[model samples]
Target: MTPITTFFRNLEAKCCASCGQVISEQAESYATECYTCQDQASTDAYKHYYKKN
Candidate 1:
């Protein structure tokens, strides 16, 4: 409602490290990436880890 409140809220906003997207407020405070990027990274890692020679 107030400008100061809005400013402080914006300060809490975070960006994803991999996709340059805004991280949701619901995400962990220490998260470095958005959920989408995190999910993609997890999928990639799973694929790589399970890949058969």
Candidate 2:
């Protein structure tokens, strides 16, 4: 089976907009939120799911 890790590797070098630390794209969206500064982005996935209904 293909490891999901490979797909996530590229996002590792992404620096957090709030914390300035490397955060994966996936993690940036879900686990985003600045680790050092403040909120990075919106955690809209949860709202989007219910909003579609």
Candidate 3:
């Protein structure tokens, strides 16, 4: 399947590519990583999951 970009409403949910966490529409616009996952990550280094702060 194609990579998830924008979130969809009234439809199926999406998962984070890094941590498998559920991605919410209100939490973001594009889909690749969830807020929690992204919060602990840098834009360039997102290959793995890590707690940054």
Candidate 4:
């Protein structure tokens, strides 16, 4: 593959919020219970607290 093509392919892809894992390129939907959806700030705060413990 060309350098430009390879660069784009290596680019970070969309991901799921609940798991923080990457979603497939063909993924139809892109939202979880919170975070990436409605309760984004709250989800982030929870994750922060959970990680700090």
Candidate 5:
């Protein structure tokens, strides 16, 4: 692959917040969560932190 390709690939890659999976840079910049993480978060209520009584 060309250096430009590598650079763009690197530039476009991002790590997931929960699973540490590499996501798109656009997703990372535009969103706080990735696809997988967002899906999981939506289904898993326990994943969120609760306040103490």
Candidate 6:
């Protein structure tokens, strides 16, 4: 690949909002967190919601 292409690709790369992990280019456009962080957040939310009931 040309240097210009590489530069543009890196320039457009996205990172996880929570952990700063580099997000995969193939990931969904609306995803803001990495899979690991997403899973942890889901688990925490589940526990918190259930504990209140």
| TM-scores of the candidates in the order shown | 0.68, 0.30, 0.46, 0.29, 0.45, 0.68
lDDT-sorted candidate list, best first: 6, 1, 3, 5, 4, 2
Separate clash counts for every candidate: 0, 0, 0, 0, 0, 0
* Worst 10 contiguous positions by lDDT, candidate 5: 44-53
Q: Worst 10-residue stretch by lDDT in candidate 2?
A: 33-42
Better of 3 and 6 by lDDT: 6
Q: If both were scored by lDDT, which would come out higher, candidate 2 or candidate 5? A: 5
Candidate 4 residues 1-53, lDDT tens each? Answer: 57976776666776666666665544335444334444667787899999999
Identify the runs in model 3 with alpha carbons over 4 angstroms from their true place: 1-11, 26-28, 43-53
- lDDT preference between candidates 5 and 6, better one: 6
Query: Which pairs, if any, clash in model 6?
Result: none
What residue pairs clash in candidate 2, if any at all? Answer: none
The digit string of per-residue lDDT tens for model 2 on 1-53 reads 65878666754566755566775455537554445444223345556777999
In the range 1-53, model 3's lDDT, one tens digit per residue, is 54455333435667899999888665445668888877777654654444453
* lDDT (C-alpha, whole model) for all candidates: 0.78, 0.56, 0.67, 0.62, 0.66, 0.84
Q: How far is 15's C-alpha from truth in model 3 (Å)?
A: 0.3
Clashing pairs in 5: none
lDDT of 1 at 47: 93
Residue 12 shift from truth in candidate 4, angstroms: 38
Error of 4 at 24 (Å): 32
Model 6, poorest ten-residue lDDT window?
4-13
RMSD to the hidden true structure, all candidates: 4.3, 9.3, 9.4, 8.7, 5.7, 4.3
| Candidate 6 colliding pairs, count | 0
* Model 5 agreement with the true structure over 1-53: per-residue lDDT tens digits: 57966665666456776777777655327675679788877767554544332
Better of 4 and 5 by TM-score: 5
